[model samples]
Target: MKTPNPARRSERSRRAILSAAFDLVAEAGYAKLTVEAIAARAGVGKQTIYRWWPSKGAVFVDAVLSLSEDDTGGLSLPDTGDLRADLSGVLRAIVDEYNDPRLDAMSRALTAESLADPTLNSEITARILGPLLEVTKDRLRSAQRAGQVAADADLSVAVELLYGPIYHRWMLRTHPLTHEYADTVVEFALRALEPAH
Candidate 1:
């Protein structure tokens, strides 16, 4: 008789665990989510979750990422050579995403937890926000080459300029996040990044 494929079983279990984590967080919020609950929901042993993830936060990050995976499996920004338009599109999309109730709840839960756990914060940065930041930086670099952005402009800070206000407004609920607001941010960012005379 052929031996059972342990690797396949492991992958299946991992997928199940991630899905369970996502579902639980969406249904009950992050505060109510627990490793034990994930195990029960996934039909796997608690040890199975521990074997792969260091904490519930890690599993949750992975779960959220898995659900948001695109067909390209990468966070891509539009690059139509019109930097202003591209930036507007990206920021508007971000506003749209943040406007989603499920995503808003999930983001708030993760942000709250990360404040208390430095390790989880690092994991969230590396696994969730890191790729998107890198992609945005790359897009800015392309704009620099196209002479749309100042050659000496600090790309890191430039990225912040584009996203910081939106993040600030969203986190603080200072104002409603909308596409028009996103476009306004893009306008300000473009002005700040305008090529030197």
Candidate 2:
């Protein structure tokens, strides 16, 4: 008999689990999410998820990343030459995701959970924010190399500046998120980081 392709089955299981996690979180919020529920929705045993992830938070974060497909394999900065337009386009895409109600619900749930669970807060960053920040920081370092950003720019801080305003509005509900707002944030944030000459 031909040896069954275990990798293919594993991939299918992973996709189902992630899709179930995302749908459940978007529908019920993080506070109510459980591994059991995900297993039920995924049509897999709870052991399947545990084998792949350590906790529900990890699963949820992975699920969100899967749904968002943020392209984390490398620093995904567009290099069409204009830093402003490139950054604006990146941030605008982020803003567009925020505009989606499913993502909005999931983000809100993740944010709320982070507030009450210090460990989870750290977990959230480790699973989601850490990779994203590193990629963006790498992108900023590329800009520095290209003379689009100041040589001495603190890339961590610059990356934060790019995301912080958008995160604030998204988390606090202080204002409507829009492409205009994201572009404005990119403009203002880059002003301080741009080459001094």
Where is the poorest 10-residue window by lDDT in model 1?
67-76
Q: What C-alpha root-mean-square deviation, in Å, does candidate 2 show against the real structure?
A: 2.5
Please report, in order, the local distance difference test score of every candidate based on alpha carbons.
0.87, 0.82
TM-score of 2: 0.87
Per-prediction TM-score to the true structure, in the order listed: 0.89, 0.87
For model 2, name the residue pairs that clash.
none
What tens digits encode model 1's per-residue C-alpha lDDT throughout 22-64?
A: 9998898887889999999999999999999989988988887
- Among these predictions, the greatest lDDT belongs to 1
lDDT for model 1: 0.87
